[model samples]
Target chain A: GESVGLHLPTLSVQEGDNSIINCAYSNSASDYFIWYKQESGKGPQFIIDIRSNMDKRQGQRVTVLLNKTVKHLSLQIAATQPGDSAVYFCAEIRGNTGKLIFGQGTTLQVKP
Target chain B: GAGVSQTPSNKVTEKGKYVELRCDPISGHTALYWYRQSLGQGPEFLIYFQGTGAADDSGLPNDRFFAVRPEGSVSTLKIQRTERGDSAVYLCASSPARNNEQFFGPGTRLTVL
Candidate 1:
């Protein structure tokens, strides 16, 4: 069975600091990976994504690093702010299917 | 009107009852998907629809679960004889094409007591 999972269940960071969330997947065939931020009572919002062909992708203040060799993925948020506090999930897309398998979320708490 | 939307934000029913969850994808989107998320767990793929037909239904847990999208815009996920363990948040997302970026709705929180 293929599974996408996170390395931590919760992470606490102070405002003005950088935050990193890690994910390790067992599906090597998965070509695409995405990061989603989900605030309480809201749907998961797309943050950034990376393809297997590339190892890294960056958004406004977010970065996604993919290590296909070890099936590892990580999301980096710079200058973490209180507004960045949320549950973050990493999802991998299955080839040819619109299905995205989500990983156990990492709850990020940013304190000012 | 811009993003995916779900109805009845919350659902509560007794065990052995049946319930239906609705999802409205973004207009003109061709791909719709259903996912289940239990507390403290990640969302699990339930089923996927490409246009008016189901392209993949392998993630459906059992016979008690079913889904349909006749016109390919809105979809309904039906659960029959729901049990206590069937309680969870049902999430719906839509994408313009296969494997493309998807937009998710707020999700329907189902509690089977």
Candidate 2:
């Protein structure tokens, strides 16, 4: 089955440092991608999104980079803060269906 | 502006019982979604409603899982003959339209013992 997967299960980063999380997806037909942050006991929160036509999209302090050739996506967070400690997931939307297929999350541990 | 909201933040039920989870989407949002997330994984799509109709429900695991959005606002996910595997965090999200960013609520955590 086509799926999205993360490269690492846990990523430890020191406060004030930059953090990067990577995801690989198998579906070549996916046209949209999103990154979500989920804290303890809470639902996933929308972070940033990018379209397949665009290679990169930037948010406040976050950036999403997409490589369509390799079917890869990455989320970069600048100046990591303690509040950023949570599980991060990359999801791909099925064409026109708005159904998000998520990858096994990567836990971002920001150490203060 | 309020985001999505779910009822019964936590539910503990025995096996073979039935459960209904409710979702109150953001005002005027026309799209609502339901997902189930186990302990160590991401949220899995279950159903989606667009303006009082279920546009897609391909992700529903089985016939025991059902959902409705009769008024195009509040939606409910009903599960019958619940088993231990049904114990997971049920999350609801809403978007202003299709292909838009979804706002999620604090999920309802169900523990089926």
Go through the candidates in order and give each one's DockQ: 0.84, 0.88
Flag clash pairs in model 2: none
Tens digit of per-residue lDDT, candidate 2, span A19-82: 9999999989888999999999998999999999999999999999999999999999999999
Quote the chain B TM-score of every prediction. Answer: 0.98, 0.98
Worst window of 10 by summed lDDT in candidate 1 chain B: B1-10
- Runs of candidate 2 exceeding 4 Å displacement: none
- Pairs that collide in candidate 1 are none
Off by over 4 Å in 1: none
TM-score of model 1 vs. true structure: 0.97
**In candidate 2, how many Å is residue B13 off?**
0.5
